[model samples]
Target: MELRDIDLNLLVVFNELLHQGRVSAAARTLGMSQPAVSNALSRLRKLLGDDVFLNTSKGMVPTPLSERLAEPIAFALGTIHDTLNSKAEFDPATSARNFTVAMTDIGEISFLPALMKRLSEVAPGVTLSTVRNTAVNLREEMENARTDLAIGFLPDLQTGFFQRRLFSQRYVCLFRKGHPLAEQGITLKSFCAAEHVAIVAAGTGHGMVDESIQRAGITRKVRLQVPHFVAVGHILQTTDLIAVVPEAYAKRTLEPFDLETAVCPVKIPQIVINMLWHGRHHREPGNQWLRQTVFEEFSS
Candidate 1:
């Protein structure tokens, strides 16, 4: 393929078509007419020497070459978009931008208030929305720019994504402050024998904590399982069942409800929380501002 012969804009259209998976939908997304998109696709196919896409009942299925180029092209286009978008100077005081983030309920509990407070003081018009986190397809969601950022411990992350260590904290065993185990720190044997309130949801790594315990030849009987940390309090308050949770959230939300946490009796790895983004926005001015703001806010 001769670099001078290929229409560069057609590559952008190709990317959009691959992403949207339909010519008409891609046209709508790019704000171009369907014929125009089709024309761009034809040009792109001719230049690349591939069918690129096959129209099927399911939708546009990309050829192997198109599938292979999808990620790199998307990343490259995203970088160009961020670069061009930032050519206009940012005035945070007057600029109103909506940033949608994906975070766990506990992250919202720990960081949203401070983040909003800072935004109100510095950039009042800026808005924020936090989406629920799920186990499956999160990487794909981020890659497609559906979620601007994700905050948590994502294990085995892929290349072409950026991650920054936000903070790390040990897991704490939470129970009512005056509960029996709270008086004396739980022993490994006692902890393994006690009833637990586990958090179970689709696509969570926390399930591994249970697996690790079993691998150690110890078993902690789980009496109840809850989806979110906030719900753990309600269950802990009424029963002797203990819940293992992140120390930061435990310190913030559980204490008021007469809950207290102690170092876990068994050896568990410290949880390292990180903020993640697609490399496309690494140098974006506004994204840099937001990232630094979050880092400063959380570090304090």
Candidate 2:
């Protein structure tokens, strides 16, 4: 490939094409028309003296040259983007910057309200957007600067990521304060005998709550199952069921749901929640501020 002849703008288009594998998809993502993307590809081909991609029944298949060029082009683009975003100083009060966070529904319910409240006091112009932690490739997105940070029990983010400990808490049995089980407190017999509402907090490592309970040779008769923890507070309040939830999460559920919690008779490992970001963003002033704000607000 003729590296000196490559137009930086067309390289952006080429990278999108390689990722999406279709001209229309790349065009839509880049906010350009299909013909514009096709033209860019043509320009890239002319510079290289070979077709970078070929239209096949499957899609636009990359030529050997394009495949070879993908990595370095992506690295160059990512470096440029990161350098620009890494301001020497950040003034959140006046800067109209936006950040995207990847988190589970539980984080939305427990953390967002307080975080937004604080941001309102300090950085009213800054905005936040959240995507489901499991819905996308989080590591890739963060590395590319498409996502700013992630928060939760995401064990999969171990490699190539930096994390700050928020807190760790054990599972507790939670139910309405007025429930019959509240009178006796939670004993192993009462906990197992009671009907329960189970939370299937998919992809956030929250399923550990249930798995640990089962491993303890104890099982609650789960009468209902919900996909997220946003509803756990509501369900527990309105029913006679109990749920095992992280102690920190249970604290948030108390007043709004009029709930009470007791130590889980089944001892389970504590869950450690963290705020995670890619190393590419480690030195950015805004990223630093955001991490500090979150750690101060939520960490124990």
Candidate 3:
């Protein structure tokens, strides 16, 4: 495994394989022949003394060693590309940059409308895509450079990531307008008696609201459990089920729909929503612009 004897070009082929998942596909992406890419992969495997990738029924899968190396290699490539094609400054008025952000449905529903309005006027050429938040693995995604920014409540972010508190919010119960509960303010006893739609995620049956209710020696029955808060709004529109949602999202998402908010029968602690990013781009101009734009948008 002499460093001097190893072909540096093999790493590029290896990275392309990891990105494209097949030798033929990787060759097409790298603008090289399939046999040449396969030869490079074989030489790389021998030089490293490990099978970096293995072919399976589905396709080529990266070995654990290769999986561990993927982030560093991808970051190195990105940095090299950025350095070679560096822009002196990012001009929002003229530049056409597409940004990919990861956020939950609630974040999209709450922020996208206003954010888009601002972006249309200021950065008309810019575009955005929202990645679904299936799990709370935001730190890993951000550190790997797979996402530009993650907008959510990541309570267990790693140390290398930075966070800026966008705003603080709390949970409030939402129900259809002119419901039975509208006559009187919701009480703990009456809240438990009503059917509820639980916003469950990450295999947890209860949310922060349920925890607060438990602390008060009350157990609210959760009749329906769904993954996204946007679904909660839809259900509330047609059903008698009540849902506890983030106060900010509840206000924005329920505006068009016929819904009313009632003070949570049980006191729930407020949620501090923050924007998270890896320190790798902590000083980069484009990332700085995005962070500032999002902060200003949310603040206003």
Candidate 2 vs candidate 3: the lDDT winner is 2
RMSD of each: 15.5, 15.6, 16.0
Model 3 error, position 269 (Å): 0.5
> 186-289 in candidate 3: lDDT tens per residue?
88777989999988755222366667877899876788988767678778888888888888877885677889998886888887888878898788777788
How many Å off is the CA of 123 in candidate 3?
A: 1.0
C-alpha TM-score for every candidate = 0.68, 0.71, 0.68
Model 2 lDDT tens row, 216-266: 877679899988787888888888999888887899989999999998888
Candidate 1, residues 1-300, lDDT tens digits: the string is 576886778988988888799999999998999999998988888888899999999999999999999998899889988997867556679879887787887888888988999999999988887886684466777777777787777775659888888998777788886788887678887787779998875455466667667777887798887777768777888888898787888888565688887888666678788888888768767777788888988862
Who is ahead in TM-score, 2 or 3? 2
Q: What's the true lDDT of residue 198 in model 3? A: 85
Best lDDT among the predictions, by candidate number: 2
TM-score for candidate 2: 0.71
Q: lDDT per model, in order?
A: 0.81, 0.89, 0.82
- Model 3: worst 10 consecutive residues (lDDT sum): 201-210
